[model samples]
Target: MRLSARLLLVCLPLFSLPGLAAPVADLYQVREPVASQQPEERDAALGRALETLIQRLTGKADAAQSPALAQLRKEPQQVVSKYGYEGDALLVEFDSISTERALRQADFALWGANRPAILAWWLNDGSEGSSLVGDGQSAAQVLRQAAQYRGLPLRLPLADLSEQLLATPENLLAGEPDALRSASERYAADAQLAVLARESDGQWQAEWRLWLGDEREQGKAQGANQAALADALLLAVSQRLAPRFVVTPGAATSLTLEIQGVDLKRYAELQRLLEPFAAQLSKVQGETLTFQVNASVEQLRAQLALAQLHEVTEQAPATESDAEAATDGEPGPRILPRTDVLRFRW
Candidate 1:
C-alpha cells in the first residue's frame, strides 16, 4: 500500500542486553509496491520480489541468478505459500521450509533471523535546509521500508539538540564510530551506520560508513530520490554484514565456550546471544561460566564479538571476571577442556 504511510521507525531504548541482536519476524514475507495490477506488471513485481528474498536470505545480490536457482526462477510460484494484493503493493509469503531447502541445495550460506540491529544516524541536505532524520521523522519511512525488504533491523536516534550537534555532516563523513560511540551506547546496537546525503541537480548522492564490531565499511551510492537511495544503502549494508554471521549447512560443530562473569543479567543476555547456537550450560566455576554450543566456530566468535567480547586465554574468564583473581591466588589454573574450546573476555 502506497498511501504515504506514517514513519514505521520506532524509538527503541535498548535494554542493557549486550550482544542481544534483534530478530526479524517475517523473514519469509516479501512486499513490493506495484505500478498496476496488470498481469505483466504483477509478474515483473513477483520476479523482483523473488530476487529480493534471495538476497535477504543469502546476502548475495546475485544469488537468484545462480544455476541452482534456475528452476525456481522458471517457476517462482513453486515455493510461494500465498499471494495477495493490498492497495498498491504485492504481498508474497514464501514457504520457509521449501525456500530454505532450495537455498541449502544451492550451497548458499544462510543468514539466520538473529540479525544485528543497526543504529542509523542519517542527515540530508537539500535546497530547503538540512535535517537529521529522527525515529519519528517523515524521512525515516523510506529507510524503514528499505530495511524491511532487505531484512535489516534498524534503529533511529532521537535527533535531539545534542544529537543534532554531534551527528554533523563533518563527523559522519569522517566515518569514525568513536565520534558517535558515546551517543550510540544508549541504543546498544550491534552496528552503527552514519549517512550523509546531499541533493544536487535532482540527483541524490550519499556517503555512508558502517561500524560493526571491529570491521569498518564505507560506500557511496546515487539515486534519483530518497526512496531509491534508502533501498540501495540498506541493500549494500545487508551484503556487507550477512557474510560475517551466515551459517553454512553441515559446517557447524560442537564447541565449548568458557567465559568469565555470568551474573543474573548477563546470564540472560548471554543465553539470548547464544540461543541461535543451541548453547547448553556445561558448568559454573567461580566467576567462570561454561557453555556447550553447537554452531560454526567462526560465526560464534563473530556473534560474540558484537557484545564486545574478545578472544582471551583461559588465564582469565571473559566478562565480569575478577582480573585480580590470578594475583589473589584463586583456585589453581582452571582445568581446560580436552575438546575444542574458545575463551572470551567481556
Candidate 2:
C-alpha cells in the first residue's frame, strides 16, 4: 500500500500516537554497502548498520558504546527480520520488537513516529551573491538530506509574493520573530527552523534558530563547507527536538488520570489506546479513570504528548475538604501540581 494510505489507516485505530504509524521505508531499516556478498562480510556490515540505526534513533552519536547495546552488536542478526541487496547496498529490515528491546534495555528515550514537521527558512550569503534557499535548491537539498538521515520531517517556505513581502534575507538573518512568524503562518508547521549562512575568509558561518510550540533555541556554527555546517546545525536541532531521555531502571511510578467528558464509547477507546502502553485501567467512576502504569510520570506524559487525542491542562489542587466533598455524583476537584491529570479532547 501507499505510505500515506497506510498512515491514514493506522491513524484511525491507533488515534494520535506516532509510534503506531506505518513502518515502511527506512524508518526501521538501515542500508550499508558491503565489499562482497560473502556471509562474513554481510554480517560485519549488518553490525555496522545496526550501530547506525541506534545512533539515528537515540540522536546520540555514541549510542552504540552503551553496555546494553553491545549485545545487539555482537548478535546483529537477532534484530534482522529480513535482508536483501540492491546493487552494492545491503538492505536490512529490523524487527520492531527486537529494536525496541535493545532500546528499552539501553534505557533510551523512544521518539515515536508521529514527529513534528519543521518548516525551514534558509538564506545563504556566498562570495557569488546572497539569496534565499527555495525548495529543490542545492542549499535546501543539503538540509533535506540531513533531515532525512535523522528522520526529521522538513518543509521549505513557498516564498510567494506575500511571503516575499514579509520575510527577506535581512529579517531572517536578524532573527526577527515577527517576520518569521508572518511568513511561516501559512505553512502551519509544528515547528520553524530559521537558518542564515554566510561565508567569510573562506569559512562558512551559520546561525540557526528552532521554534517549537513556545520553546525557542538558537546557535551558531563555523565550518569549512556547507556540509559541515549542515551537519552541525542538524545535530543541534536533533538534540533539542528528539524525545530522548536516560532511562532509570526500576523507577517506574503510577499516576491517576482524571479524564473529563468521557462517555462509554470514548472510555472504551481510551482503554484501547492506553493498553498498548501496558497501562491497566483499575477504576472507572464517572469520567475519571485511574490507571496503573509501569512508567515514570514524565515518560507517560511524553507518550501522551505524542497523541492528538488529549490536551493537558494544569489545574490547582483541591483542598482536603474539597476532595471529600467531591464524591456522591458531584464533579471532583481538579488535581493540582501533578501533571497526571489529563483531559481528552473529542
Candidate 3:
C-alpha cells in the first residue's frame, strides 16, 4: 500500500522558563539550504519501508492495514524525510515517542511500540544494512537533542527602485521601501531570519523588522538600533510565543524527572553559568524552584561527566538525518522530492 506523505512543521518552544533545570533547548544551526528536499516522498518511502518491514517481521503483508496503524500508514512519507538537501549528510537520527521527530528530520515516526516494531523489522531484514542511517539515536533521543527554533523573522518583497539610487551611497542613504523590501526578501530566509543595520555618526544601529502576515495586522515599530536593543526585542518576540512543542522520551511510559534539592543561591549561580543553553526562564514559586535547583545540580554533574568523557570543543556537534547512510554506498547522485512542511514565507 502507498503511504501518503505531507510536510510536517514542528515549531519547537521559543522560550523555556528562566532557571530551567536541564539544557532543554537543542540548538541547531542550518549550514545548508533545506529548501529543496522532498519530505513527502521520503515519508511515503519510509511508510512503504516500514510496511514492508512489518510484513517481514510478523509475516503479515497487511500489517499496516490494521486500524491502529492507520495514521502511520497514511502519512508515512511525511514521517521520514527531513531538512535534507543535495550533498548533506545525516549525523544523527533519533527516534523519539513524539510526532516532533517528523519535523526535525524533516520526517515522521510511527508512535507507540511502533518504533520498536519497526526496529524489529529492520533488524530482522538481515540485509546487512541499516534501514535508517542516522547516528543510531532513537527518535526521542534526536528530538531531545534538537534546540528550540526561534520564531521566523519578517520577509518583505521590495519593488525595484529607480536605477539612479544604485550608483552612490549618498543616494542609497535616501532609502526606498522597494529597496528595503528587496533586501528583506534577499537575506530573509525560509526561517524568516533578517539582517538590517544602520549607522549614524559613529553609532551602529541594528534593526529587525518583523512582518506580521495576518490581514488585520498593520504598522511596525522602529526602535533605536542598538545590538542589545535589537537582541532584546528579538528575544522578547521569539520567546513570547509558545511553540506547539513537546519532548518524546526514548522509551515507552512517562519519563521520570527526579528533583533532588532546593537551593536558590546555587540555582542563581547555575542560571548565570548556563546562560548559553539557548533557553529563557521566569521566576516560579516554591517547589518549582526547588525542583529546578536539584535538576541543575544533576545537570552540572552530568555535564562534567560528559566533558570528561569527550574532547573539549568550542562548537556544538553537527546534526544530520538517516540518509547519510546512502552516501558512500551509492556512487551516483540521487534526487528527492520537496515539500513545504511549514509556511513562514511572507
Candidate 4:
C-alpha cells in the first residue's frame, strides 16, 4: 500500500489498484433487493442479479439472453464467487475474469471499469407538491442505489438555494445544457443529466436528458414508483454511454502512446484508463512517458477522453511544391508518422 511506487513505475507489478477517484470500486458486485430468502426466491434473485451484471458489462439490455451465455444462464451459480443476504437485499459477487472471458469469447464488446461519472440534477413533482432532489436529501438514496445497479457512478448536486433555483421544472426538462452546465462546473463530472419526474395516481413517469461531451442522449421511462423509474432511466443512460467506450476483441494492434506531464495522480488515473488496452510502460523522459499497448484507435481515444487528455495531431506532409523547394537544401532525416502510435498531452 505504499503511495510512492516511484511515480507508479512499479505499478504493483501490473498496476494493483487503490480505491480510485473515478471508476466504480466493484464493477462485478451486484446488490439486488430480494423479496425473501426462500430457496426459490433466492435462486430467482441470483438470476436477476447475474442479468444485471451482464447488462452493466456489455451495456446491452438483452445480453443475458445471448446464446453464448446459455451455459452460464443455466448454471449462474458457477460464476458466483460469494453471496449473502443483508436485510432485504441479496448481494452477489461474480468472478470478473470468468465473466469477461465468457463475454469476449461470445464476441461481445466490453466496457472498461473506468466509466464516466454523471452529475444528476433532478426535480420531482407529486400531486401534493414539487421538490428538488438534493444530495443530502433522503430521496437521493434511491437514485444512488439505482445508479449502482446500472454500474454508473452518479453525482448529485448540493441542492443549495442557488441549485434549487436552477432546478425549476422547465430547466430540468430543457433540451439545452447551458444553465445546468454552468451550475455543474464545480462538480467536475464527465457528464450532465437533468431529469424531471412526476407521480400521478401512484404511477411515476420521467423525462431525462444526458450530455456527455458533444454527444446527447435523451429518453423517457416509467415505473410503478420512484425507485423503478430511477433504474429504468439509468439503464438507458448506461446503454447509450457504453457504445462509446466498448472495445471489441477483434483487433489486437500493438500500439504505442506517448503521454506528457506524468505525475502521481495522473499516473494513477492513466493506469485505470489504459487497463483495458493492456498498456505497458516502455520508457520515461522527464515529464513524458511512452507506453506499448494493444487496443483499437477509435475506442482508445474514447477512453482517454475521460481523463481530458488532448490528442496531438500530426502536421500534414508538405505538398509537392513545398517538397521541391525543400530539395534545394540538404534534406534532414525524415521521421515517418506512425498511425499506431498516438500522442497526448495533459
Candidate 5:
C-alpha cells in the first residue's frame, strides 16, 4: 500500500453542561505603525488612521473615490471604538458604525498591510453564510471570518473532518464516530465549511465536506501503489473540503495569525493539532504562538510560584481601579487577551 502523509490541526475547546458558556472574543495580530493620541482626539485619529490605512493597504490609487472608501467616508452617528497595544501593533475594535464603511476601511487597511495577494476574506451574518461565519466553529471557519473582516478571499483547503482523519497515519487517524463526536466537542466546529488553499509549492486547490454520521458502514479499504496514494488522498480531501468555487490569485501567499485569550492548559490538544501546519509553514513571523508566560508581573509571579521558587522581592500591588480602567479611554471590551498567541513583533 502507498504511504500518504497528511498533517491536520484540530481546534476544539473543552465543553461543559448548559451552565457554562465557551468564551468568545476576537483574537488578532496586525502589523505596526502604532497609533497614540490624546483622550478626546483618539477616536477621530484612529478612525482616520484606519481610513488612511485602508487606502494604503488596498493599493488604491484614489482613496476617496473607491467604492469601499465611499461607504466609510460618511461618518456614522454612533462610532464605537477601542484600541490597545499588542506586542508591536495596535489592536482596535469598532462597533455599530452604521454602514459597512468601517469594515470597508479596516478591510482595505489589512489588504494594504498584506498587499496584492490576500490570504483570505469572508463576511457572514451567522445564519446567512456557512457555519464559518457567525459563531464560526472550525479552524477553517475562524480563518475565513478573519479573512472576511479584512476583505480578502483566502480560503482553507480542508473541511471534511472524516477525510482529514482517515488520511493520517493509522495510529494517528480516528474513525467517523469518534472523530466527529470527539472532534466536535474538542474543536467547537459546526457541520459545514468551505476551503480553498495553495500548496507550499504554489498550486491552488479547493475542497469541502460536511459532517456525516458515523453509523454508516466504513468505506472499503484501499491498497494503492506508492505513487497513487498521494493522488488518491488528495482527491478525497479535495472532494470533501473544496469550496463552491475557486479563484486563482496572481501570487501565492498565506496569512499567519496568533490568537490569545485561551487557557494554555485547557488547549494543549488544539496546540498539538496545530503543530503539523506549523512545521509545513514556509512563510511565518516569529516562532510558534505560545501562551504569554510573562505579560504582567502577576503572571510572572504565578509562574514563579508554580516552580516553587522563593520570591526575590515583594511583588508590586495592582489595584481594582487599574484592573477596571479602560484601555485608551475605550470600554473594557477592548482589553480581551488574544486566544491563539503568536510571537510576531509586528
Candidate 6:
C-alpha cells in the first residue's frame, strides 16, 4: 500500500523532545560562503547549505534535484533552526525534522547518527620523509572537511608514544591488520581507513584501503592536489558506508509491535524515538502500536538496525502463569515470534 498524504503529519509533535536528547552531532548543519549580509545573499547561501545537507542526508550528490527539495528551498527558514557567522563563512543549522520530511517526501534513503565512526590512519610520503598525519596537521584539515561534507565521522590516530610503538609507516603502508588494530583499539572506531599518499610530477597519488566491520575495499586515486584527493577518497568511502534507497511508490506495508516498559512518559519518548523512521503510527492500544511504513520489510529492518534501538529477538511461547505474571508487572518471561511480531524493550 502507498503512503497517503497524511504521512506529512508524521513530522508533527517530534520537535517536542528536549534539546539535551539530541544526537551528539547536528548532521543537518552546513557551512557556506557569505558574500554579503544582503537578504538575497543570505537566501542564496541558505539554499547552498540546504543542498549540501540534502546530499549529506541522501548520500547522493544529485539530491538537489529531489522533488521535495524545491519546497525546502522556497522556505529555507522552515528547515533552518538558526544561522550565524563564523569568520567569513555562514554556518546554517537545519531543523532535523523538516530535513527528514523533505527526504521522505523525495523517497530518499536515510542514515542516522548510530552509524559507525571511522579511524583514519594516513601517511604522507614527501621529500622530507614518510610521517603519520595526526590531529591538527594540515592533512587532517583536508580529511576533516571532506568527511564533514559527506557526514562521515572520522578521527586520526594520536601518533603518541603508544601509537608510535604499535604502528609505523611501513606497517601502515603494508596494511598490517595487527598493527592497525593495536593502534585503533583506543579509538573504538567501527571502521578504519589506511592511506599512503605522495606527490608525483605536480599531481597527488594516493593508495587507500578501507575496512568496514569485517569487509575490506582498496583503491587508488590521482588528483591535482590534496583537496582533490580528499574529495575522491571521501566519495568512495561514503558510498560504502551510507545505505542506499530507491523510490518505490505504492510499496508500503503495515506492522504491529508490542513494547515493554512503555507507560505514558515512555510512550511519548517512544514516539520521539521513532520519528527518524518516518513511519506513521496508525494505532496505539496500551503497549502495542501499529505502524504504516513506506518501505519493504527488509528495508525497514535494515533501517532499524542502523538505529541501534532495543534489541529484537525471536519470541518463545509463554506459559499461562507467565502471561499472568507479566500482567501483574512482575517481569515475567515474554517472547516475540521471528516474523511480524516485534517486542521493544525500553
**What local lDDT does model 5 show for residue 319?**
51
2 or 3: which has the higher TM-score?
2
Q: Which rank order by lDDT, best down to worst?
A: 4, 1, 6, 2, 5, 3
**1-82 per-residue lDDT for model 4 (tens digits):** 2233365666535544332126876899999888899998999989999999999999999999999899988888988999
Predicted structure 5: clash tally: 32
lDDT of each: 0.82, 0.66, 0.28, 0.85, 0.31, 0.67
- List the candidates' TM-scores in order: 0.81, 0.69, 0.20, 0.89, 0.25, 0.64
| Tens-digit lDDT string for candidate 6 (85-189) | 887788898888877877777777666654456788887776677767788677689888877866777888877666655555566666546668766777766
What lDDT is reached at residue 72 by model 4? 87
List model 1 lDDT by residue over 199-303, tens digit each.
999999999999887689989988999989998988999999988897777888988998776555456577667877878877767656788998888899888
**Residue by residue across 213-308, what tens digits does model 3's lDDT show?**
211111122244333333343333332221111122221121112112323433343334333222233332332321122122222333222112
Evaluate candidate 3 by giving its C-alpha RMSD to the native, one decimal.
26.2
Residue pairs clashing in model 2 are 18-114, 317-336
What's the count of clashing pairs in each model shown? 3, 2, 30, 0, 32, 2
Runs in model 6 lying further than 4 Å from the true structure: 1-24, 34-44, 71-78, 136-139, 161-176, 221-224, 244-337, 341-346
Candidate 2 steric clashes: 2
**What does the lDDT come to for candidate 1?**
0.82
lDDT of 5 by residue, 88-137 (tens): 44555544232234544444321211111111111111222232222233
lDDT of 3: 0.28
RMSD of each: 9.5, 7.3, 26.2, 4.1, 23.0, 9.9
Q: Runs in model 5 with CA error above 4 Å?
A: 1-24, 27-71, 74-80, 84-88, 97-188, 194-205, 210-346
The candidate with the higher TM-score, 5 or 6, is: 6
- Could you tell me how far off, in angstroms, the CA of residue 97 lies in candidate 2 after the best superposition? 1.5
